[model samples]
Target: MKYLFNLPDFPDSSFVMQITFWTGKQILFKNDALVEQSGEKGKPFLIPDGNGKVVKAYPKPSLPDFAPILIINGEKHRIVAKLPWYQLVLALLPLLLLYGGALGGGAGAIAAMLNMQVFRNEDSAAVKYFKVIGITVAAFAVYFLLVTAIYSVIA
Candidate 1:
């Protein structure tokens, strides 16, 4: 059976991240948190009320915080700084282009939002901008299709 999840704020989003089964029941996980519970499975291993799935199902593997980065672009450019995810992305912006060129960060931003929920948020400025760009592109595609159809009919 199909199930639906409802979240506030991002009201238009369900964002069913990952689904995993335990024993026979189905659990819906989102943002590393189990948001929905279903099925009939008696307690076997853990707590009596624990439908088998814990709050943290798949724990993020601990990653070694240290790793040397070697960059070769005629001159050796070594990035020896430790930074967080956002910081790393920002820091690596300039280095995104390997061959010395404009690394189209705008395109990168749009492409990265390939995920439906984040990309479709009308409230987000980035999402709105991307939607405008997408609509413009779609308009062109439709126009071309119509023109082609008309040409075919005329010819």
Candidate 2:
């Protein structure tokens, strides 16, 4: 996803904008430039402007905390753009429902298939399949344990 925002009071001069993801991935954007570069985790990088001033880039504390600070000539600017937590939860709801549906054997399988379709476009094939299988297995394991407990109680 592309994050777009304006930094009020920022100098009009061209400068580099850097973003470090929670997964240790980095992306760099040049002012009025379209090229992107990867960044290193836990390492500080310089965003130099043509006027000889440099801005420093740092990663946020954890996932969902999209605030990254930019230090321009010793002044700190915290970028406050972030994806809402509800939106993220909504995206993952299908996977959670798929697991819940797994409590029923054949019915669960159908539900899982339907739920998997929701994420078909969001992730790559490998990732999508991996998550689907993983959740299904985990749900089946939980269901088995529940059944075993009930059987023991009845006997």
Residue 98 deviation, candidate 1, in Å?
A: 40
- Return the number of clashes found in candidate 1: 0
Candidate 2: tens digits of C-alpha lDDT, residues 46-81? 555567775555534333333355544455555544
All candidates: CA RMSD (Å): 19.6, 10.6
The total of clashing pairs for model 2 equals 0
Task: Score each candidate by Cα lDDT.
Answer: 0.34, 0.48
Q: What stretches of model 2 exceed 4 Å from their correct place?
A: 8-24, 33-41, 65-80, 94-155
lDDT of 1 by residue, 1-155 (tens): 12233333234434232312122233443434555432334211111123553322221212221122221122222222244575334323322222322233333323332222222333676655555456435434544566578779999
Clashes of each: 0, 0
| Candidate 1 Cα errors over 4 Å, as ranges | 1-122
lDDT for model 1 comes to 0.34
lDDT over C-alpha atoms for residue 111 of model 2: 35
